[model samples]
Target chain A: MQGDFYQLLKEQGYVLGMSGQAGVGQALTTATTILAFKYRDGVLVAGDRRATAGNMVMYDRTDKVLEIDRHSVMAIAGVPATAYEMVRILEHSFKYYRRTQLQELSFEGKLRALSKLLKENVPAALAGTGAVVPIFAGYDAEQESAKIYFYDILGAEFEGVEYAVSGSGSPTIRGILHYVNTWGEQPLSAMSEEQAAVQALRLLTSAAEFDSATGGVNREAGLYPVVKLITPNGVTAMADPHLRSLFESNVSKGS
Target chain B: MYEEPYRWVEAVGNRRQYLDAQFAQGSPVVGVSCDQGILLMTMSKGTPKLYEIYDRLALGGMGHPADLEKLRFTLLEMAHVEGFNRSASDVTGSRLIKYGIAPVVKQAFEEVFKAPFIAKLLLGELGQKAGKDGFLTINYDGVFEEKNRYAVLAASSSVEQRMVEYLRPQSCVSLKDAVDLAIHAWAIGDRAQRHTDDTGGDPKDGKGSSDQPVADSQTLMTHIRQCMQGKSIECVLLDRHVAGTSKYRTLGSGELETLLPKDLSSALT
Candidate 1:
């Protein structure tokens, strides 16, 4: 069963029309904007809930943030189907390593594993039908600290010193994060998990304001960006009500 | 280059019997349900037999090392696959054992693969509802029985006898009592005398250790220290009360020391 399932999935394929050699003519309508940062308690991972198909919003409650394991999470920013299959494959691979080895993989090991997965999908990525860019964040038990890793389509792993953001709206979010870090009295790492989560939501809201692909917190439908806190305690998604209040509070403050 | 013909041929032997014989030499695993949650204790001679199947689910195996590894691997893959296929709230220890491992082991027994895994399993998981934690004892041959209080695997007859004798008919037990009873069961192999040293409670009384349990956590910790002299014991607790992320964790020596009756810092010395 090792890599057998992945091989089977490879045979099935993600893009309905594309084959091994053909490239997707147009970009896939996809979710955008995933931001992660290390704070005092742990790493905060966030993503907007909107999935856009071209100019039209395909889904408003799409979840781009996925829990990879108990301690780690990944945010997908391309080809929803490919992203899901990749997550499943990675999740199975991580658990397989833990089972056979009887120990969890190191943070570096996890990054390498993700890299391998992305590298294997290089052909599909080149075909443009199966591209997935992800931001990974987790609490490293051995190092006793929160860590964040970003990956390109080619699966090049890059460790972010303070924060990492991905997808089309990343530029906007990154700009805001830079502004916050430079203007704030303390480094981003000094902020609490709650503060970091709030900052992430605010940044995503701003991204949604400027970028059509990103979705803002919708008070009417009660949908909010998915926010997860990966603390020493464990990885948990912030409750909708909490995110709602944060949105309301932030909105109450004038621009 | 010459390739060995029939390389996949399994050596002719009683594989099931051989697997069981290996378990005879494997470590003892004891699981007990207490007020705090479920406590799973096992001796580690280097290689670990305990595994976290999920955030709340865990499995402890005692059998052929290869078979144990296979079982652990298959079980975890099934769990994660099942979890990914359904909602997270749908996955549970009992469900994994009942619907997941049970089928795999059943197939293994049917010789779906090379040979059946010779691994007895003790599974513990935090309950979906608060205070509903579960513990299950599974035979290597796919037979399983749900134990409310406690269960033991690959142990001396006396240890099994003591567990059945001490925990039967009890509705609930405290974490301290569970730890003491599990260790006491494991320690029974060394202590040949049948006398109840802690509080003189009759060994056969079937009163359930929690009925008039003599040892407090501290006293039991000391007793455990005395029993485990010159030995390192691996302990895990699936605490239901643990809020946030994961409810299962291995107890560190430092934390275990804090639970001891006295500073047994030099007890082994």
Candidate 2:
């Protein structure tokens, strides 16, 4: 029993290694197309709801953007099994630290904790079975502002000052975000919440056009990407109805 | 030597006596379920006596701060680990007391050579609906009881019983009513405790005497007024109406003022 839930799990012999488990990674269910960027109020995080196993669409209603706490969210882009596990550990670790220490974990400490988990999963990641590249967007209460961070499979972390993108469809959306942020009418930070959401939908739609793994939108089934906003208040998920209206008026109408 | 089984039992008995004396001046904690959710209130000289244990759970205790903190951390570790390993819904008050805290506190009490945790803890869990709320109280010796609607923790068993009896029939429909009821119930327990202290009564013997006239409302008001001179009130709620998964929240003084009565609210400032 320790403040670090991950350490406690490890001590209980629940290892995260995937090497000995043969044939498990052959068609691993991998989630794709997660993006985060700064807007007027705070950071906007969006992820397409698609899980792919090789060339097969395994699930369409997967929630890639997970709220870790009141002020933080994690958007995963790789293997769902390992990514979900990491999310569970990170959620408990943050809450456990707060309860035991009588204070919130420092933003730096939180980043380091996630990095440690990824580092510990280095074996699985290196074996090509459990690679999770994730974007973490959170409101730093101490700093009184929102921030974005991206992590690699090897545990390296980098601050995404303007935006960060991940998964198989990232290249397509990444180019569009760069072009828009640099030469469009306004940079990403100046956009409002609605504009930022619209841009995210547009980016995912373009990625879906180019990448086979990103499920941009399913109008008949009313399935849209998960979009959440991290502001000074807290993280709030955009409801499907709101997303539907935004997509219809802004993205689907080709305006 | 404690090597002998009888000596070990004697030592454990002595530890219980020591603990009872230590809690002589400790304040009482009152918790009641209302339409809003579960409300926990306590009067403290300085240190906070209420805490948010988990997403749907809150805690109140009467004991040494250090011991309470030790147990709080233990419970927190267990809860988060269980919640992470299993799910949040699986981490209930009874499970936490039965499987997590009770064993640790019991071991410490029985060890004889080891210092026991001198804390009496009350945990409240907000259920999915109004009628399903649960409360559990754990004594220093790790004996616990699962209760419904309301629970109270006092320095002695007699005082706890009196407080429970006073609050047994009261049903609160709003946060204000719940706060009001809890305060009065707390005053009952505190008044009895002070009576015992004044007379040097042995708490273990349940000598706080039932015939001792229950303080009238005016007398209770005066007692609470005098006690509030140097103490602060700690109030927490597990709001079922909250938007997120975590329902635990601390009521700030500003909100407490609204919920508390005119004179009591003014006395706090």
Candidate 3:
């Protein structure tokens, strides 16, 4: 209606007759398990590498973690197509704001924008065609620390106190993270960056054990979980070699 | 020269003259990209006109204020559409110039119904890769050129010549050095401007600055302070090797004061 890209696409006669309600009639390959929390220095954000369509494992090396901007990341846990679209829109809007305004969006500003986007997709989400929930993690410049936010299907934003998890496998993953972060002598709030990363990998591994939709590291195919560290220094993904070594060590340690 | 139809040639000629007159009045804007990052400086005529086009891109121009505003809105909208159509992270300085900006300026010139933009645009982009920062200057008739080390926009022939001499061998200058160089070049231009009768013709005003005498460094410093006073003189930076969250930022007036040499800075009101 308004001369946006979508409108341009329609005017150019690339018409998909389905209503423009977002993610209608698209094959839904759902990704699972994203957990984020504050660590000693910054935030540790991790996602398991699996996507499924009902009983079929559609993808084994899918990337559920996405970089939203310089200081933030979004981990998706619903229809992969819908989530990807949401991520692209958010990225464009954020970059547009920065370019025109000459400043990064405040942490609260980002939350509001994402919430609005999810709210707009409520139609498709309710119709069971485009349900997308994402966990947001970022280094809050004003607060001077890492913070995480969770969202429901209706886009109600909730701040995570110690840690947060989402996806079909989230219930299992959340339980494991809560236990590891709260029940130990050195819980998540007290863990170093290295320890937090290790715990994230362990949580994903534990989630895959019970949740059929979730997948742990695939050693034969050299596929590993995506783990990112968001700090004042910037975002850095854990290398495959390091992930492999960490997985081996964690598995070798008998429970 | 390409032959033009007789009917519109007079109109085109008149437009050229009008634009040339406009350029004569605008203050010189200068920028440099070095190892430290990129520095863009422009003389403030009152309101701030510089815009950050993206995380690593910023733009400033001197021309008709209305035309500048129109260009800003159009360019920003086009870039937003481009970002939406593709991945945002992939949108870089080169991509924006090659795909979005150049074409739009070209359109303005080629279309008869559209008046040629009477502005000089200076664009600075932080290097996406190591040692790849870029600076670009675009003229009114849609002529665009990329500069490696330094670039100047909206300067007179006399001032441009002086700038060419000052900014030679523009390699690996520190951020503070780059800012200093920009200021010095602008001062030379401003000093030369005082000798000319019509140097201060405000493109915005039908008339424009008084014919002042030549300035020494102290007088030049004073003049710079006076012009920049009470204005939000903005500076855009693209830092390399900095672990900070944002390599791009707009430095405030206080932060800018810290970057100036101690002697010139001490006299700031």
Error of 3 at B26 (Å): 3.5
**Candidate 3 clashing pairs, residues 3+ apart or interchain:** none
Candidate 1 clashing pairs, residues 3+ apart or interchain: none
Error of 1 at B12 (Å): 14
- lDDT of each residue in B149-254, candidate 1, tens digit only: 6777753233355556645654546666665566655544223212332434332332222343333446545555665554567778888778643567787777
Order of the predicted models by DockQ, top scorer first: 2, 3, 1
Write the residue-wise lDDT of candidate 2 on B133-235 in tens digits.
9999999999999999899998899988888888888778899999988989899998888788888888775585454677777777788888888788889
lDDT of 3 by residue, A1-255 (tens): 222334344454533212234555555778598899888888899999889987889989888889888788999999887788877766766666666554677899888878877887787787777788999998889888889999997889999988899987789877777777667778787788777878888888888888888998788898889999999976788998988887788653542
Worst 10 residues of 2 chain B by lDDT: B204-213
Q: Highest TM-score among the candidates is held by which one? A: 2
Question: What value does the lDDT take at residue A37 in candidate 2?
Answer: 98
The lDDT, on a scale of 0 to 1, for candidate 1 is: 0.71
Best by DockQ: 2
Cα-based RMSD of the predictions, in order? 7.8, 2.1, 5.5
TM-score against truth, every candidate: 0.73, 0.95, 0.77
Q: Candidate 2 has which clashing residue pairs, if any? A: none
Model 1 C-alpha lDDT per residue in residues A34-143, reported as the tens digit of each score: 99987888888999988887788989998888987888899999878878877877676666566556667778877887887788778778887777899999888998
The model with the greater DockQ, 2 or 3, is 2
TM-score, predicted candidate 3 vs. hidden true structure: 0.77
